[model samples]
Target: MSISVVLLGEQESMVRQIESYQGELIVTRVCSEIAEAVAACLTAGAEVLLIADAQQVPLMEQVDELLSQGTAVVYLLDGSAAISPMPEVLQLPADIAMSDLEQRITATVRSLKLPEGSPERDDRETADLEPRDKGRIVSFWSAPGSPGRSTVALNFAVEAAAAGRSVVLLDADTYAASISIQLGLMDESASVAQICRIMDSGSADISRLNAACSLVQVGDTTIRVGTGIPRSSRWPEVRPSALRRATLAFKDHYDLVVLDVAPHIALDEQLSFDTQAPQRNAVTVEMLGCSDDIFMVVQSDSVGIPRALRAIDELEESHADLQPKIIFNRVSVSRSGRSPKRRLIEAWDRFGPMHDVVGFLPNDSAVCSASVLAGSPLLEIAPRSSLRMEIRSLAGIKSSNLPKKRVSRRFSKSA
Candidate 1:
């Protein structure tokens, strides 16, 4: 079968060289710019896009999007510098013999075209299979206040681990990462950042995650903690693509992957300036996009409610299909007025989006404060606290230690 192709390059020499090639791959269009080339590929219904110079592409995110649309990309390299291998992208030296390049292209196209159940396709599928018991990634986010997002996430992970599920807690907040300090592990190195760096270098594996993480034990359970960046100024280190890869690696190795991320999810930086520039909140945004379940925590106050409503709007704009469970933290009569939970529910139904409030963590100032001061999860610091019990219920963790209610032995027989 003849493969449709679009050729792109920054330099005239490289474009001229690729265009002069004589092969079965038909070059339908030649574009000097990234956007133009991408548009041409879609409009012309091309199957393959051959980029002579990868450096010319400003936004790697755009390349990812194109690849998602099922267009095969071939990056022709001048061999000037080494680059990490990107998934599904073919890279070859531009100086290779045209005949050799043609053969490689034909082979790659043919492999991609192989019908399902064919021996080669089946073999590849068998090799690519992930473990049947893959883990779930759940993320907790808030509206940029001390809404107890980190606290909730930490306790939830502990509860999950205690319930016999292998859990990994990831601190993915780029602006302020407190999981390390919260867990009382004051190491300067950030495991999440280190894992992202390793992923970007194309060397990420389960061993890398285990090596980068710190093990924290609560009761009889141990949780692998992926600590966040020590300094907020180093947000650039956790790129979106790398973070996604790291999260996938975590999911493959654990039964539950819990992420605590920053409140910011706006793409303002990408829209206002050069799209290729690093995004400050990209880590949080990427986690939101990838997580199977998202818990949106809001403080039960006038200010917190308004802020959370705005956050919901933002989520609607960015992730239309996301049905995040709304959780109210620090529910109290003083802040939310009389009958706090009921009143808060009424207000949310009237003012907020369609998403219903999932659960409320009641105000336990004494217990929460003590846990913070002690640098421990509530499950360990105050397992019987109301806040802890609520969190346990929310996380679906059942404890046999709960006091049973006395049943009235005298039952009035209606019969």
Candidate 2:
């Protein structure tokens, strides 16, 4: 009863097989090659793609592209006399024999069909192919004292930019106004206060905000740094709305936006009692809530695990949707202290399903000292440090991997 189509291989025999089942078979277009077949299939609005045995390799290369276009594939293998890789072909979930493939193809078509008279589907049908212009917000935060959240954020942004992605590093830690000083870019003018004020007034747009941001060029990478306000009283101006607007502007202009958030809420009078302003805990909540991904930094020690656990609990309570990846910083393999990995495993056994542990970095004093003194990222000051390599691996910024692209459909109305 459903319309079926075949491409490129013994079309007459395929049509005969479809007619044998008393089903409507339409070979609206035919081509000698895979590319032409794909184009024909797209133009014909074919729901099921029937690729013969010889055309599998070329078809596989375009799997993602085809899937993005909302077409499901059904590979039709040759019925051979004992000398082919039928097992391998069958292993693929999409491939199936023509004799038994009709029902499966019909089901796939039905599943992909848009609901009749559905507004959502109609909106998606008319939506643009380009992804919604928004910057990817990645936040770094840890428990009390020092967990190197700023260092991780700074270096990660640098590494991401070095790998050829436009990046912006934001210092959202209101309690500590030291990023500008730490990065050696400190000056009376290197402040985010004015930008926050303008954004709060609703007069600042993305272009204007970008122009106000400071540009820091390292090697071939360029990064925009948002220095924190000098006084904690100015946090009201740096509320979530302001931060969100700033990052939205950043995303429009940059590939990645990284936020270095303060570990705890600032209890200054301006933020504590202002009813109109964001609550004291708002910044932490906003950062964790908006981040596409979060990195939880922790020291590898007895005290550190308990502290990390508390932070996790707080994060779960405030931002239930956030699933942070834990990175055990300052890990030592020698039996000099408690094993960081063992401690992490114990935590995982109890709360493993809640959080993901991406990787661990060893305690390298040289790297830390170099970062502090030079006011530069670990990769630039101490490229040979084991910590640097670990960070690179965790961030997936290696040159061997293909650069990540913003999948257009990821932002579509259908999603």
lDDT of each residue in 284-321, candidate 1, tens digit only: 87888778999999999989999999988988897787
Q: Which digits, one per residue and each the tens of the lDDT, describe model 2 over residues 1-415?
A: 6564645554566656566766545555555677777776666667556665444334232433354455666555444422222111121222344445666555555545665325654454334235666658888888886867777778788788778888888888877766666566655453466566555543435655665667776554567777787676666557555565566557667778888887774334454454433554567666776678888887767677678888778767655667888888877765224765776677666853457788787888777876778766665566656777777777786634422331111101100
Off by over 4 Å in 2: 1-134, 188-190, 265-278, 334-343, 351-353, 399-415
| Regions more than 4 Å wrong, model 1 | 1-24, 27-131, 271-275, 402-415
Question: Over the full model, what C-alpha lDDT does candidate 1 score relative to the true structure?
Answer: 0.78
What C-alpha RMSD separates each model from the true structure? 10.9, 17.9
Q: Pick out the ten consecutive residues of candidate 2 with the lowest summed lDDT.
A: 406-415
Candidate achieving the largest lDDT: 1
What TM value does model 2 have? 0.60
lDDT of 2: 0.63
